[model samples]
Structures are given as C-alpha cells and as structure tokens.
Target: MSSAQGGSGEREESRPKDVEAEPAEAAAETSAPVAQETSETPAAAPETPTEEPTPADEPGQAAVTEPPAAMEQAAAPEPAPASEDPAPPPRAQPPNPDGEAKPQRTFTPDFLTELFRNPLDPGYADAAARKAAGNGAVGVPKKILSGVSALTLVALGFLLVVAYQQTVADEPARTQARDTLIEQVQSRRENTTDLSARADQLRSEVARLREQQLGGAALAELQEAEAQTGLAPARGPGTRVTVGDGPSPIDPVTGERSTEGRVRDTDLQRATNALWAGGAEAVAINGQRLTATSTIRQAGEAILVDFRPVTSPYQIVAIGPDALQREFRDGVTGKFFRALNSQFGMSFDVARIGDVTVEAATEPNLRQASPSPQASVRPTSSPSEGGR
Candidate 1:
C-alpha cells in the first residue's frame, strides 16, 4: 500500500510537464507551415536569407520565440517584382476628426524662382521672352476663349433681334391709336363749325320774323343793330392793308436761319388799333369780322384772330367814309407800317377799293343775361294826376 501511493504522486507531477510540452509542439507545427509557405512563394523567398533562430531547450522559451517570429512575418510584407507590377498611386491621407480635408501643396521650380525674384528688376523682358517662346501654360487656349466669346456675342444678338421683333409687332397698335386721336380732334372741329353756322342761321331767321311783325321803325332798328353787333355782312367803299412776314434772317453765330424778323401778335394789334383810331366804321382782319370782344393774340407760332388761326399775309379791310384812305395814310398806322418795312424788311401795302365785303362775326353766347321785369312794366300815374 505504501508503494502504490508513491507511484501515483510521481505520475501527477509528470502530467503538468506533458501539458507544457504539448503547447510547444503546437507552436512548432504553426511556425513550420509558415516557413514552408515563405520558401514556396517566389516574392517572399528573397527575404528569407536566414531562418529565424529556434528557441533554446528551456521551459516557456518556444512560446516566446514563436510569437516574435509571427509578428516579424506580419510586419515585413513580401515585395512584388518591379517588371510585372505597376507602382501604386499615392493614397489620400484621411481627413481630420472634424471631417475637414487638408489643403494640398503645389510646388514648381518656376513659381519658386518668381516668388523670390526682386521687384526692382524689369519684368517686361521676362514677359517678352515667355511670349516669344510660345509657352502653352502661360495663358488660356485661344480656341476655348474664342468659343466663349462667340457664344456671348450670339446671345447678345439674339436678345437684340427679340427686342426688334417685339417693337415691330406693337407698331400696328401704336399707329391705330395715333390715327384714332387725330380723327377725334378733326371731328370735334367740324362739329363746332356746323353748330356755329346753325346758330347764325337761326339768329337771321328771328331778325326777319321781327321785321315782318313790326314794320318800318322796327325794321330800321334791326338793320342798325345788325350792323353794330357784326351780325350782318357789310359791303362798302374801304381801304385795304396787307401785311406779310419778313424774309428769314441769318444767325451770325450759328449760321442758321432765324425767325426773329417775322410778324408777331403785338405788331398786328398795333396796326389794328391805329386803323380804329382813324375813324374806321367796320373792320375785318384775315376774313374774320372784328367785334367788341374780338382778340388778336398768339397761339404757339400761329396768330389767332378771334380764337381762329390766320397766316401771313394778313389783310385788313375797313369800311368808312370816302376819306378813310386819306385819313389812315396820314395817321399813326402809316408811320408804324413804314417803320416795320424799313427795320424788319416786312411787306406792307395799302390800296383803295371801290367795294369791299366783310363777313359776319361768330355768334356770342349770352349765358348770364335775363329779361328785366321792371323794364317791361308800364309807368302808373298817382290818383291826383289821374283826376286832373
């Protein structure tokens, strides 16, 4: 029984030793396969100059040595043949933790040389040299620039054509609008003239009816009123005066024709006043009868007589006694006419006519006048005067 116990103890101690030896054997097996693989591969064969030293015959030595050999094999990759394989392209570095890529650097010998060159040196010579050498890198390609310019010009031309077409399309509407406005103005003028003629005819008819109702005295009164109010045409012996614009004068500074010497409203007014002062009974200017309310004025470049435009040569017809021509020739009008002729080179002519006719005046609008009730009432006598 004592011998049996001692043998069991010895066997238990040997078991631990066997366990440790098993691990070493496994490591050796793994390393042998790797070494064999390296020898077989042509790429890794050149690096296998000498085999890795095996561990010494000591406990735990194989485990330590095996791990280092494995690490070295992993660290040193096998090199590929230069002739059969292409060089790998440069790999981009990873971005920062913030996800921002780093800026790349560009370096050229010419750029570096220019950066360090002195500013005092002449740069024109270098520019000339570069231009003469016809370096393609100096500027953009001519073909590309020309293509861009052509595209820009084509776009501009297209826009201009579109604008012109739009204007042409709208032309008919614009012309129609202009013609409509002109027609409206002409129609209004014709309507005014027709209404004036109708009013004059009605007045003449009323005067004729009054003449028939109240004979001799009333008829004479009506005739006198018509003459005074310029409602009846006048035909009598009169003096005729004609005035015309002077020739256009040359501007000394601009060498252009000037209208300064032309007849004006003031000149016409002066001539008319002088004729009235010479005891003229009836007067008419440019075929327009002059009444109490008649006005001689200017509208733009035109002369307006009684709100009607008249052109040169203006003719003044006056009916008076046979001595009218003699009186007017010796009056202020004759002197003014002489002055105008000499100063402005205007045309002024006076003639005596045997019989001259003057047209009736435009009807005046009586908007505010009302018949007087007291005027129509007969005068009443007191009781004492009635008894007598």
Candidate 2:
C-alpha cells in the first residue's frame, strides 16, 4: 500500500521482480516492517508477468507477504540461516574510484570522551530499567546479601573489641616500665654529676695538703717524677716538626686520583717511631704528651697517640737540649723523611724553638715492686720441710 522513490528516480516497470532479499538484509528486515515496493527496478531485465502474493482469508483484505531470501537461502523464512549458504551484504552505493576503503563517518564521539562527558554508564540505566520493569537478570537474592553483610559487620565488630581489650591489657604495664626507666635515667644522671663535683673538690684538697706537708727532698723527688713521667706540663728549648699528607696525582690507567700519597696510620706510626729514635725527650704530638707507656698505633684511617686521635698535618713538639733539632736532622729520621718527600710528595718541616711548652700526659703508667730474693727468709720454710 506504500511506495518508495527510486534512488535514481526510474519507473518501477519493464524489469523482472528482483524480489529476493540478501540474507543479511532479510535479518535487518525481520526486526523492522517489510520494505515497500520501490518505484525503480534493480536492473534493466525484460518485463515479465508478476505473480502476486496469496489473498487473505477475509474478504476485501490486502494481501501481506515477506520477500524471499537470496538463491542461497531457503524459499521459506528460516529460524536461522543454514551452515552452507552465507549471503553477501547488500551494497547501496558504488565502490570508491581510488579502490581504497572509505573512512567511517561517525556522529558519536570516542568512548572515553563520552564517558568523561557523561559519568553514568548506559548499562547502569538499562539495568535500572530492567529492575523497574520487574524483569532484572537473576543473581543473589537481596535477603541473602543483606544477611551476609550483617554477619561480616558482626565479625569486624568482634575483632575490634578483642583488639581493644588486648591493647588495654598491655598498656598499663608498658607505661609503668617506660616511666620507671625514665626515672632511673634521671636519677643516675644527677648522681653522676654530683659525684664528679665531689671528686674535683677532693682532688684539689689533696693537692693543697701535699704541698703543705711535703718537705725538701720529698718535694724535689715528686717534682722530678712529675716532669719525667710527663705528669706536669713541660717548658724548655726543643724542636718543632710538622709532617703532612702527600700530594695525590691522578693515575693514567685508572683515570682516578691515587690514594697512595694519602697519609695512613702506618705512615704516622713510622714517623713517630723515627722521632723517638732521634732522641725525642718529653715529646708531645698535637698537644697530647707522651710518656714511657705512651703508644702510637693505627685505628682504621686514624693515627692514635696514647689512644687519642691525631690529625694532619701532625705537629710533633720535643722538649730537649738546644742541639735536639740538629741531632734530629743528622739522625735517620731526616734521611727517611727526605726520601718520603722526594718519592711520595710528603711535606716535612723542622725548626729549633728556644722555648716550647707541652701539655701533660692524660694517662699514667702503673707499676708494682716485689721484695728481692736475698731479703726473703728461708727459716720458716726449712722448719716446715724438716718436720714433714
């Protein structure tokens, strides 16, 4: 009862009825109403008599028919296309002149762009519509879901209660222990400070009493011991010797600065030993005085003189006769240091000082004496042995 204008505007006459639809086109038509008769024909076939659709059972009713699928498809409408015959798509337009694929023209924007533009997903709306219509996709029941959620909440609450109880149980003991430790630390610190002050007072008092009580020979002997043992500060003519790290040159092979020239603990130990060999009397290095018990040793990268660290450039002060500097230069110390200077780029300087003061050594050498063998009596031992 309806008519469609031809795409080329030709009369729908003088052509065989090209009534067969493409399988794909038939699928498209199934979802919609049957296509109306086109005013234009498909091809310029010779005119043929038309076979009309069968008439309806009711009188004066218009005949209704569906177009047949292509030769590859069944004559009757199919529930689904068979496996053997697949129909080609119907083309409404001619192919491009250049034979290249046509660029798809879309009115809608990209998916991400649309997602950002509209935050709500279309599927959510469709699901909500299905729910409103009381035909939602089957899943877990609401009652079961709600019961499970309640059980989960109850479990979480039980865990929280247990955790809080455990914390409460431990909190008091931990707090008490921390407070006790703090109090003990504060008390010990105060006690130590008080003891230090008391010790200083006692030391001063003892010194004053010793000066008042000790007379001529005793006083002189004490003074001599103090000077010899480096207990008292020294002031006399001596020599000043300064030794420093050598200059480091880059190595050609490694392309890095060589560490060979750097002053090591062993180097300082050797240098100090040389000074002792050169007859250094009451020597001090970097203000740390040296006694007979004093030691020069290596600790990691440091040089320790009597357990005290000495840094470069090392300053060695020797308190001795006016000839001390000259003797040091004439000794092996001078020749060895000169070799160091020539080979390793080490710096060494010596000067004779008319007056130099050296600080007293901080530590003392403890010694004990025993009675001579001649003084021991044999009478008591002999009596016990004779009786046995």
Candidate 3:
C-alpha cells in the first residue's frame, strides 16, 4: 500500500506540469494563425497588431508578440501599383457648334451715343435751361438785343436818308459842273482830231516836195530804209509756224490736267529767234508786227508780245527767202519742238506760203530831245550899233 501511494503522488505532480505546458502550446498555435493573417493582409495588420491578447499571457509576453507581427507587416508587398493612368484630364466643354467667338464691343461710340441722346444732349437742354433761368450768364435776352439793333439801324437809315436828300438838293449844280467838264473834254478831242488831220496833210506835202527834189535813187533808198525799219508792210515768200497747247494729260500725282503741257512765252520766243536766225526779214506774231524793240514774255497765263496779249494757237509769220524753211528745220527751235512733241504731246506745225504780208508797226512817240548850241544862244547887238 505504501508503494502505491508514492507512485500516485508522483503522477499527480507530472499531470499539473503537463497542463501548464498545454496552455502555452495552445497560445502559440493561436498566435501562429494571427501572424499568417498579418502577412496576407499587411495594410489592415498594422492598425490592429495586438489583436485579442491571450488572458494567460503577461504584459512582457504581449510586447514580445507585437514585434514579430510588425516585422511581418513591414515585409508585406508595397500597395497595389497606383492606378495605371491618372483620371483623364477633365474633358474641356465641347466648343460651341454655332459660330466663332463674338468680338467685344469697344467703349467710345457707345459712350458718345448715350451722352448725346436726344434728351441728354448738352447743347439743347443746357442751352434752354441757361436761357430760361436768366442767371445773368447771358445778361440780356437775344430778342431785346435784336430789337435795340433794329432801332439803331433805323436811326442810321434816317441819317442816311437826310444825307441823300442833301445830295439830291445839290444835283442841279453837280449836273452843270458835269456839263462843263464834258464840254471841255469834247473841245479837246475835236482840237486833237484837227491837229492830227493837219499833220497828215503836212506829211503828204513833205513827201511830194521830197520826191520832186530827190531823184529815183534817193526815193529807192528811202523806200528801202522804210522797209528795213518796219515802217511799211512787207510781202514775201516765207514760212508760217503755229505752236499751240496740247491736249492736257491728267497728272499722276495731283490727279488734274497739267498746265505745263501748254505753249509758254519761252516757246514762242525760241521760235521767233530761230526764224530771225534763218534770215527772216520781217516777223509778225498773231497779226502784230515784231519790231526791233518788241518783247516776247508771259503776263500771268497769257503770252505778251510788246505788252499786247496774244492767245494760242500762236501763228508766227515770217517774210524771208524760201530757204527759211530749211534753216528752221535744222535749228535749235526744231529740236526743242520735237522734244515737246515726244515728251508733252505739244502741237507744232510749219507751212510755206508764197504771199505772206506783215502789217506795219505802230509809230513811236519821241521821248527825248536836246536844243542845238546855236539855237540856245541869244544874238548880242553889234558893237557899231552900240557905239551909235
């Protein structure tokens, strides 16, 4: 019996130790399942690492269990690769299908239109208000000023009427004075006409006396002198040159017909000079005789020969030998005219005439004179007469 009891006590002590060991094994098994779950689901595992702790484990045992779970979570794969592409850029609103963008209206015209609208116009409304207010800005109404002006004008008119009456009252005396002046002018004109007639008669008498006293050679010399001095008309075979303004062309820059295309004074002068150089004895332009002192110049737009205005188409008549035409063609005037024809479309014409007659030039008045020494001296009485 004693041997049996000792064996039973020893078996009971071994049983208690095995029971404690079984609880520890059971805790390890439960922890092994938790570690496996933490490795599989790492994202959730970090949040609750110390999941439900065993009641039998001490604080030190729980601390040790947490480190292994944290290590397992760290070893987990990185989060599923970020979604492949970012959300497509917010789609832009589709463009309007109707039309292009409308332009923004500017401010100036709109502002001005609003400011100058009928009721808002400053000129009308402000002027009316200023006038109606009678604020001394304008001092007096336009009607009162106009009435005063009318009254003043009426007074001036009355004064003018009085002056006119005085003038009318003196009209008879003025008429007598005017009659006297007219009589004096008529008498002077009649005297001048009589004197001119007497002078012509005296000239005719002198010519008759000269012809009777002088022989045929002297008469011929006088005639030649008169012709050379352009005192008598000339008739001969020569050329006629006509220069005229061309049909005007529109100016490119000014958009008007150019006046430069017209015949000028210089052009006529050049033609006259060319004719004279070609041995022209007598030259006449536009029916006016060209004397030694005649001038070809421009006065305003018209050409003046000896101060007399002549219009185009200018006809220059020359009395010379038939060779004048040939000489004129080879002269500077011919070249210049050709250039005008090509460049400005001027009109130049030349023709030979068999019977060309040029009128005589007007006689000139004497401008200066000096008395002879003999005429200036008065004769002294003879010495014999003085002695007597």
* Strongest candidate by TM-score: 2
Q: Candidates' TM-scores?
A: 0.49, 0.50, 0.46
Looking at candidate 2, the ten consecutive residues that score lowest on lDDT are 7-16
lDDT value, candidate 1, whole model: 0.59
lDDT of 2 by residue, 157-196 (tens): 9999999999999999999999999999999999988987
For 1-388, candidate 1 gives per-residue lDDT tens digits of 3332222222112112333223333443353334444332232222221222211222222222222222222212211111322223334333323221111111222433332431212222222222333332246877887899999999999999999999999999999999999999999999999988997788879877888898988788877777756777777888898899988878899999877667898988887787777777678898888887789999877999988999999999988777878777777778878787898889988889999888778655454888876655554544445666
The window of 10 residues in a row where model 3 has the poorest summed lDDT is 98-107
C-alpha RMSD of candidate 3:
40.7
Q: How does candidate 2 score on lDDT?
A: 0.55
Candidate 3 TM-score, true structure as reference: 0.46
Q: Number of the top candidate by lDDT?
A: 3
Candidate 1, pairs of clashing residues: none
Q: Is candidate 1 or candidate 2 better by lDDT?
A: 1
Tens digits of lDDT, candidate 3, 1-388:
3332222222112111223233333433343334344443323322222223222322222222233223231222111111322223232323423211111111122333332321222222222222333332356777897899999999999999999999998998999999999999999999999988887677669878988998799988986766656766788888999888887888799898778779999999999989988899889999888878788999888899888899989999999888898778767788889789778888888889999888876553334878856664455554445666
| TM-score of decoy 1 | 0.49
